[model samples]
Target: MFPTFPHRKWYEQRIDTMEELEQHVLNAHFPEDAYFRGMPSADFICISSFYRQYLQDNKDSLNWSEQQVGIGVTMSLPEVGKQQYKESSFEILDYFYKCLRELGSKELSFNSIAYLAQHYGLPTNLIDFSADPKISLFFACFDEKEWFTDKDCTLYVSDILWHVKAMMPSNQTIPMGYFKHPTENRGMTEAEADEMMFNMFTTIDKDSSETVTPKIELDEVKYSARIHNQKGVFVYHCDDVPFDRIMHTSNCNDGFNKVFVINKELKPKILEKLNNEYKINEKFVYPDVEEDPNLDLILAAAEKTKQKFDLP
Candidate 1:
């Protein structure tokens, strides 16, 4: 089914049957650097749950900022938009790392914490993809609950690494302010804040000839049981824009990124084949393991982390 709502669809091809969907995957040539993502619906834009939630939460504030200010009406919230959110994301991430550290994860990197948080059902800026297209197919056919056949699902294919390397803007300097300590008593003076912000964000020009890349492909090191089982990889815009938005605005031509829209009617058939034939079901994709001991502590840490951020 074609989506009734307005959404960005790229090089979208309709797959009418299970055989056709398999044939497309079989016949198509995926580059060595390619990554695949699947969604339960065609209309879903490629964005992280955290970013999506943030946008939804501040929809009114965002709209207010976009409109012209009128007499006697004040802008109640600080201007909230994509850029500001991106800046705030860094601080939030630092808090997650600190939280994990507090829970005895001293050696874990920020990226590792991000992967763990995502797998554990926490909202994060990381978007999951798989190196194997078959895994993507399983996800497209089955939502976590059950077979999602109400509408057409999508399997998005792209060499995102290639796209970023070839098309992403380079050498852009951005202000990423410092995260305040929990026990900090005094507020930073204007000059101190400016200097700290400048130093933190200005490290990019380390080499005059080198340029910074905007997209981060998280390392392939297995961070969690589920992540390893799923052959999971993650991609995120360093600037915090949706990956689709970055691809849309780039100068590159089509075919680099493709979307296969599986027929809604064929979802059940596809899922069955995936399970019985390919052995790519939930049991296979999600490995059974004892729950993380710090699950509650981590959750509380996340709440504490968010509370520390003074986002408007």
Candidate 2:
């Protein structure tokens, strides 16, 4: 029913209970570098809002010939050159960085700025994921807006090593040894792993190609309270294609993609278990920050109360 390879495969299953979900994840036996993302709707593909909007904004180009369309199906930017594509992506990003600069957050790398923009609700070619599978499930189960309450959700389990291999350009050889897997005799430090991944994703040189690569993780140089609380890491879309499309079309024999479609009726149960049993409620995922006026006032009041109680 699904594509398979000797060492990797693409598979999906309907998950009903927490135990079943855990067992399914355990069966996969993902490497330590695996990352997970949960979406409110199972139908949702792993595409960033920016690219999604870009496609929508230029719907007519969808019919253009490959040469005319240039980048790919989803990317319809004028085929003047790579500069045009870079500018289109960077326009809003530069504006975001400028705003942050005005607010005194200086010296932020481009990826750091882009991460912040995504967190603050600005669209970019980045998708959020968690190191913890259950946390991703928490996001899948809980939707405050009730927009997708009746919809089945999806939990994505991605193996970074294979994902990168699948996304690499046909002519380029992936440096598998650069990142030492947890199972390897010699393991790379967390910082080293992050730096290696960050460099791989961000560096643009003569060797880079238009072919979509597996989404690479970003280094969280900027401190985001919500991101930190959520164990948030990001996968950068290096090309114009949507993430799931790349995964499905990847030719790598060892590339693996697994998604668990959560039952709609069981969402509440899952959410309750996550919140009460696992203690992963909204507050736990989004810690209070000074930028929130309401939280700031609440914290000030609590501090005053503590001071009053301490009076001798």
Question: What digit string (tens of lDDT, one per residue) describes model 1 on residues 240-285?
Answer: 3346644444434656667788888887787787788778888777
Task: Please write out the lDDT profile of model 2 over residues 248-282, one tens digit for every residue.
Answer: 54533554567788889888987787877778888
Model 1 spans > 4 angstroms off: 1-10, 64-83, 146-148, 167-220, 238-241, 249-254, 290-312
Residue 14, model 1: Cα distance from true site in angstroms: 0.6
> TM-scores, in order shown?
0.67, 0.67
Return the TM-score for candidate 1, rounded to 2 decimals: 0.67
RMSD (CA, Å), candidate 2 to true, equals: 11.2
Candidate 2 lowest-lDDT run of ten: 1-10
Superposed model 2: Cα runs more than 4 Å off: 1-10, 26-29, 60-85, 161-198, 202-222, 249-255, 290-312
The CA lDDT of each predicted structure is 0.59, 0.59
